[model samples]
Target: MSYNMYLSALLMAATCCSLAISYLCWKRRELPIAISYGLGMLTGAFYTFGYAFEIVSTSLEHIRFWLRIEYMGIPFGTVLWFIMVLQYTGRQALVRKWLVATLMIVPTITFVSHHTNEWHHLFYKSMTLNYSEGFPLVTLVKGPLYKLHVYYSYSFFVVGMVLMIQMFIKEKLRMKKQVALMIIGSWGPYGFTLVYLSGVIYMPIDISPFGFIISGVFYMWGIYQFNMLRLAPLALQKVFASMQDAVIVFDLDNSLTSFNQSANRVIAGINNKWIGQPAVQVFSQYPVLLEKIKQGPFMEGKVQLAGHADEQFYNVHVSFINDKNQRPVGKMLLLSDVTDMVRSEITLLENARQLRELNTFKDKMFSVVAHDIRDPLAVLVNLMELMEEEMQTYGEDQQEIVNEMGQQIHNTFTLVESLLEWFRSQSGGMIFKPVERDLAQTIQINIRLLLVRIENKQIHIISEIPKDTFVYADKEMLDLIVRNLLSNAIKFTNFGGTIRLRADRSDHKVVVSVSDTGDGITSDQASMLLQEDYPVSSTGTAGEKGVGLGLTLCREFVHLNGGEIWFDSTPAQGSTFYFSIPTLSEASSKQSDSLRGGRA
Candidate 1:
């Protein structure tokens, strides 16, 4: 065969090899790296085939036509190769649309300039047919655009090689051999091109296409022998290494496959040396953790390590690691430190216990004082009343003094009774028994109980509540709430002032209110009345003494019966205290049953 035929035959072989490898990669083109690599190989095949035809062409016109065809692939193949390397190395984020377009601009310019070289002489300044080594080859004086294309192409290849080398170095234990193959494949063609461009090796024909054939062979080996495409470098190692939680992965045989940097810090004596060892044997020192892992593939709880001087709390979570097919291929253990959270909860519980104890002590002291003073005060009131009857026989002034003493004793006794009731409620000595009761009847009963005070104050009491108005509430709590509110109104109201008791109904509940025309409380006092921490007490309009416990007890009882109490008050104007109790309905009755059942 002639020399041109021989060169053509060699280029044809390289073209056939590139096409075969491209076809194999195309079959797995679903992967981004595979698609990029396949397209690159296909472009190489096109360029090689075109060069082969150019080698045997007899005329300049035919040679130039083949060169234009070759230019189509030469400019784009290098960019594709660079993108493929990025994808393989888990740096595909760099391959943005605008960035790819920017990289392609010079290559596009070169291709267009080469096609119109005859007009502008921007790709090739001169061309000649040379018969050397028994082949007809096209020799050219490259133009400025061709030199620019060369620099751009070499830059892309160098960047790709650098990225591949980085992966090979960083991923020494895992996927190292595969990365090595890719690096070798990428470097071979680039090295050959450098030699050809530098004029270091004198040859009639450019051998870069043959170097690409060698690269394709190495790439094929990486794909078939090492499974490089399927197990391309992933970012998992970097992610796990930086994680705060300790993570350990086990294989199907329960052998420790891998662990992160945090795992080493969390578990003493654990390191890369423990990899591939049976997890149970490796963690034998912590038998609880090992046994739990052996019992089932899943376990999670707070675990305390024994070696530390201070208690170390970890939230241990173990779960099966499944493959893409949802088949369990391994198990993962995650140890998250929760010492702070556990300690906070413990502190909160202790504080709550202490608070309850303090409240109990306070309630006991109040109960004892009220119990001890009641009898003595009762005797004093009786003695004063008897003295007042006798003094009426002496003079009006002496009788008035006796009457004032009797009023003071009565006020003290009333205060003692209220304190005793408050103590019983706080100490849980009082039982809560809710039933359907007439709201109006409950108010009337409280009214009768406070009749003496009402008569003394000369306050007119009006009831706007309907006779049949019923509510679901604890009867005793309701009575206590009404009595306190009425007594407060009577004590604060001026003589001849009016006090109104009314009930309003909504879909869910009935609101009972006590509105008084009296010297109302200040805004700050109203706000502090229901707060146990800040007790509010003041003398009433008629100099009636109070300790502020009545409103506090009213709030507690209302809440116990699933009700709420609030007041609208204006200083020196009047105050209206409102409490809501569930209205008697089918829904309310059922809810009451549920609450009772839960308590029982």
Candidate 2:
């Protein structure tokens, strides 16, 4: 191949590269910047393609023909690049139709003047073939119109460079590398154009096409490394400015670097003039918020700011912004207005306090009435028992009537006692004081207390509790739990039915069970049995009535003493209620023994 053929091959290589870059940018043509950039690259492809053929052309006519083709891309390339710069630097709004048409005026004039230069001699004074450097080169004398085009191109280059430099300086730290690569890519063409104008090197071909190849390579690198086109400054700024929350950025040295418009409402007197100022000074009015920001890389808390009418609340989050290597570069403070949520929470607390006071008053009044009713019922029960004894000589009917009346009065008294206990527990009037006690003894005492009713039904009582069994629990609570379970078992058991009591030690707790061969509840009843809101009221197998308050009190006292209660039941079969409480450790048993001895 000759020297001219080699030069043509170089230009063709650049043409192919520019075409590829144009295709890449065109794929993302949805963005304004990408559209402009792709058009610029397409023009670059045309410029290089024309130069490739022009470089090898031997005839002056063919050279002039290819020069006209070169003008097809050359005049408009710089204007497209300037438009791309405007979009890339968050200035897309300035790229209006009128501004674009105004910028195109000079390039369009240059293209028209160049094509008509033969008639007017305005674009080029003269054109001739020069056989210098062993190759044919088309050389044109300087014309007034050509000089105007050069100055216009150079002006666009300077303005684009200035805009890109300003963006590089003001962009976030995370985006600096991306902007730097873009600026480097743009400089390739500008630098080569300057060298070509300065006559720094003698060559038969213009070297600006090769400069585009450099730009294409750098731009491709930026696209892959930094996602340059995908994350433009225009979109970034719009999202940042449109956020409802206040966002403030600080450097590693705790100096204010950037903030959004919403931040103005949060930080008093904050503005662009505060950039580079120490964060402590900038946030001096909000010492609590500042202290939280300086404490750690990540934190979240509530803060109150003075408002026009009432205080405003904000949920502030501080997090460190990290670099590619996971190193902390700076801190970002995000303040979200939570004034409504805070106010709602305060209102809820006040309502809850008032509700609790009303509930306490209601419980006390109910207890007072229950207590007053129980005394009269108890006195009547005692009087009926005395009357039954005194009227034993009267008749069997009279004695039976007295016994029936006494039983009715006794049931009422028992119900009143259960009501008082329930109210006391609900109102927190009952204190929980756990102590070591023998489990077997306590269970035996409750069984004996309910023995009269148990025998009336002829239900067999079985005790499987070991004599040495002991637990750590409130003495009154334990007695109540045992009494209620035994009473319920007795109440539900049929004639000659079996009621068994068992206590077994497991882990740190003792499992106690009260099972009765009585009417078993259904699955739905068992599920809702323990729920406080769904109280179970039913008649016993012996036609006895109850409100199920005993079981509820048992569950409450069990949980208060750090224990649990559950039941297993089958329809038409028997049911077993189980509860677990802490067993007395060796240390606790010894302490109880010593205390009893000291009291003695």
Best by lDDT: 2
Ten-residue region with minimum lDDT total, candidate 2: 229-238
Tens digit of per-residue lDDT, candidate 1, span 403-474: 666666765766678776655554554434568998888888889988998998889999999998988877
Stretches off by above 4 angstroms in model 1 are 2-36, 86-93, 229-600
In candidate 1, where is summed lDDT lowest over 10 consecutive residues?
227-236
lDDT of each: 0.74, 0.75
| Model 1 TM-score on a 0 to 1 scale | 0.45
Mind sharing the TM-score for model 2? Answer: 0.45
Q: In candidate 2, residue 551 scores what lDDT?
A: 80
